[model samples]
Target chain A: MAQPHDRGPDFLERFVALLEGDDVFCVATVIRSDKPGMPAGSKAIFLRGGGVEEFGFGDPARTLRSQADRALDEGRPRIIALPEGVEVFLEVQRPPARLLICGAGHIALPLSRYAADAGFRVTVLDDRPEYASAARFPDADVVAEDFIPALHALAPRLFRHIVVITRGHAHDLDCLGEVLHWTTDYVGQIGSRRRLAFIKEELARRGFPADALRHRLYGPIGLDIGAESPEEIALAIAAELVCVRRLGAAHAFSLRGRSRAEAP
Target chain B: MTDLALARRLLQLRRDGLRVCLATVVEAAGSTPRDVGAKMLLCGDGATFGTIGGGCGEAVVRSAALRMLASGQGPGLVAVDLTQGPGERDGDVCGGRMRIFVDPG
Candidate 1:
């Protein structure tokens, strides 16, 4: 039986909605194979069970659903090769992750613009009301509150890529101390080499494992772009954000003086 | 284009009751213009959404998709071989083979 691809809310709408929202879903697409059952473009979306709402869609094959389940569980996209050259591309997709700008400094304005344009849900946080006003950041959500309280509010849910570009070194250290505990992939700070080294030493003394700080935190953040102006620095940080989001565990080290981010 | 944009376009097509075939590069081996997951939509009225590495190769894929749409058949795979000798003349040779999944969807 041939069925039209439902572009209505029944199928594509839900797919787009899920993509725009927070729920993580896996879309399993049959790429190629000698398998006679499914055509090449046949696809199915599987949502995680238990509290994650699973809506209408004629039930998919158990095997296909389980494969998608595995993909969702692993949180990685992979090509599943069945016996006899059946190739299926299982894409684990979610909405663009939220980028937390810890300080609403000069860099924060351009950073928010660049990050939002690059498909990040940017949130600008600062204790200063003047700086954290929504007018300053049209593209980002502004939170006029102290750093730790706001971070605490955001600590529960994942998908946080924090940039600690506070006005002063002391505030930067304070923000770093709070966010270093989270298991997020990115926690970048802007400072000179000596300032960063001092902050790292302080963090180490404060009982954050030295290796974890070294690995998780990107001190003197931004790729080696020799950025001078605030806008250029913001662009570099935005590039680093994409680098960490896309190239996980590959460029997963301190990005200070690292390779320039490739333009998309 | 992002999948969201494609979905929005698809929804518009659905509203307009316009038929279309969606072509996706399911697999690409060796040097190819577009990699896997690249997509293009060929509407009934000879309009296109996005590009599958725009060239003669895309034109061929578009023709195949139109054929599939006319036939009212389900999704099918189009094996595009770009490894032809220079004299055969697409002029743009990438020496790669791409399997495009064309769905009259």
Candidate 2:
């Protein structure tokens, strides 16, 4: 119930604080209005944590709230039309995607750097202290020594992308097992095609659902770029990660080898 | 410019006890130069940061912002229509409509 004038400091302070956090929010701005009241540039901040502040439109608070919620749900910026020739632009601000690399080995070294350059918050995890040292991964936001403990400590939802690039098949399987059930946007594992098949079969035999691996995993990860070196493979994986992040799995389709008639 | 950088400048200006006007493009139609949420900051000393497009529309907003900063009143919204008059000859024949809100702090 606090007015903008009475809570001026509070509004600016809260805005500065919100900008520092890693949660999504929407800023709704009334950009056009022909009728009286609530002129253009009137604004409101709708926080994902369930709060609205610095609201300008007095009579249409409910409508604005619902519109902001829809923008956040869609995770995109959009313009919503209100009654009486009023249009509000809802600008959704999403937190940067967090990438969890479950092995600070050769590929992860370049992968972390590439992911960071692509705007992801990179976190590297390895069982070996030498591999996970801060000196090795200067680009990573976090370098943790213990894989299982690091995975457990992480807020799974925050880490939208998880890549398992450990030293051996056993380590890859172990890393995948820790995060298989966690809600994530992308889960990729690096291995040969035959090794991926063996790992999937082994996972199926270990009480995981038969379709779980297929449904929730991207094995032999990275697009088919015919990558021969570690850096090239890292680039391929990074490209795939960017594709999945921006386009989503359902919309990301390879156009190679497809006839014009088969193109969507 | 990034929103954080603008916000930081706004905060600094406010903390310095100078009256400032923040103008933002809330609604853009047709072929406006800037998209929605584009911002411009105006200080009392004739200093400006960021921009909501340039030319006549910005000049009009700058005048209004100076007035609002002087008046110390609540925010004012101004609609800029560039579709009027002859194209190219008018110096602002972008053929777009923008609604800018000027909030004083």
Candidate 3:
């Protein structure tokens, strides 16, 4: 049921309160429209458990609800049609995307921190207790002192993204060998050009199909953003993850040089 | 997947006193990937968690989020129709109608 406009918090106030709630919710804003009543930038909120809280000055909630439902089911976002000239912007929300970084090394440190700051839930895994300490990855949602088995325990299907930046090529290969059959949204590895080639050859020798290996592997891992520092490289890797999800893995390689740090 | 996680994270961020905007699907129709009750969260600094629709739908909301964060005022209810544009005319054949609510959280 819709709340009365006068007594309840204005659309914005209620929207803010809803966003603050622990339950996941999606937000849709009318950025542009063909009609006059719905002004640009008007917004709404959709919840994960199949509910919604909306407060905006634009199109009636009824008109937008039809569109919102479709967006939620498709696991994507889309514009909605209302009447002849009205339009609404819909965005979806779910559990924070998780990244399973299977190594707690120098690279993992900054990558974990950056991923957390970038709004991803970071989890670290390493066989070394010294490197897996919470003190090292304070921002990580979890830090484990075991690599392959711990990763298996988490159930690879639940992981949204996976990044392998272990100590050396052998370790990376071992991790890949254990997890190749595990399903995940995205999988990537960090290594030098030569090391990447070596790992691929080794995997193929060990029976990993050349095609599957090629499709799953993202080596020298990250967008070619000319990233040098850990933070910069983290951004590139993050960018690649975003690209793979947004544009699909097939298009990720083609989006090699486009880096828009500008927000919006 | 990412959208839901992002929304939850946004909620956590607000515990520290930051303001945010949330979007969710209250209704949907036809052949679409997401269903009713999908959500996406938008933090004040352009940090977002979730998906409503990808591409233009997300981009438009991201732009709107900047204002929502800046104004400190919520716009209340918002909606978007996916079938209203040319690119979508040829591409998104999901034929499903959807409604979204954008508010400050």
Candidate 4:
């Protein structure tokens, strides 16, 4: 293994701070190599907001930076083969993907737990302080405020997954109206087709292209997992969240799209 | 532990001025229990932080890491072949090869 720069706690502290932010980055480590001049233990950290930082990569730092960018874009890690059979492991270090639950109600409880367990920093939001109490969502952050303002203040772009499951159609519509403007991996709303239809019509009136956002939207939220109870529904939502996070939105099976199928 | 947590612990150890031997599975081929980039930190007096898949393979890597930690020894790689001929013991059969890089991080 080639020698790396003396990376102490300062390096880690900065990296952790980045994790807490909305920026995506990459950390490429030269883990195995036979190529001469390629330092086996060197690292190339590509901070998107900042600039590139190389630690003992010496001559091959340039190539590592390119690879890091590609890995960051893909939101995945890969072993890049360099000259003379040297392989560097490039790990995409994006800001922790988060879930924003618009209404902290029955489904939010188990959904928060499941999402947190699945590595999403969850934030449960509601106007009712009692429902949005921190104790209610032990594994998630809680915000007690009106849905739209809370969404705006929290910055919907920071949350990759947004689930709107408010107590009524009005709140859901307001939340979705705010969220559709942001580019998120998953934006779901829990409601019947009629309710969502009204919301979409209202959104179209409010200047958002409802059809344009359809590809990224998951209405009547969650995977078609035959869920009945609140916990099962939360599990379905969490499963959909994982699907969108890992396998991409193309493979996600939303109930809204499969409403024709009868319940099992 | 999560990779981030392990990284934090490694940084803490380095902050304390302790040189720790970190073993990372850089490459794995066929039926390996652990994938590439899996890491295990070997602290002083034989405290192992994580695992690149436990059992005999990890032990072999640990031994190589101990050798790398010796005074004047530089960072090096360890090759472990979990593959064996047919009729090999069932409990030990994973049938893969791993290249582990051990460095003083």
- The model with the greatest DockQ is 1
- What's the distance in Å from true for residue A8, model 3? 18
lDDT of 2 at A6: 26
Tens digits of per-residue lDDT, candidate 2, B42-68, equal 998889998899988998899998888
TM-score, model 3 to reference:
0.55
Off by over 4 Å in 3: A1-68, A75-91, A255-264, B1-105
CAPRI-wise, candidate 3 is incorrect
Q: Give the TM-scores of the predictions, in the order they appear.
A: 0.71, 0.63, 0.55, 0.72
Task: Summarize candidate 2's per-residue lDDT along A194-245 as a digit string, tens digits.
Answer: 7877777777766665455544577677776889799999998898888888
Whole-structure CA lDDT of model 4: 0.76
Give DockQ for candidates 1 onward, in order. Answer: 0.43, 0.24, 0.07, 0.29
Off by over 4 Å in 4: A1-9, A28-44, A48-50, A54-90, A133-138, A191-214, A254-257, A260-264, B9-23, B31-35, B38-76, B80-87, B90-96, B102-104
Question: How much does each candidate deviate from the true structure in C-alpha RMSD?
Answer: 6.3, 6.9, 11.0, 5.4
Per-model fnat list: 0.41, 0.31, 0.03, 0.19
Label model 2 with its docking quality class.
acceptable
Tens digit per residue, CA lDDT, model 3, A1-264:
433232245544455455433444556666445656656565567555445555554337645665677777776667666675656666665556678888888778888877776667778888888888888888885555556567667766557688998887777887888777777667787876777777777888888855666556677688888989878888888888878766887787565422221101
- Give the DockQ ranking, best first: 1, 4, 2, 3
Q: Over the full model, what C-alpha lDDT does candidate 2 score relative to the true structure? A: 0.76
Model 4 root mean square deviation, Cα atoms: 5.4
Looking at candidate 1 chain A, the ten consecutive residues that score lowest on lDDT are A50-59
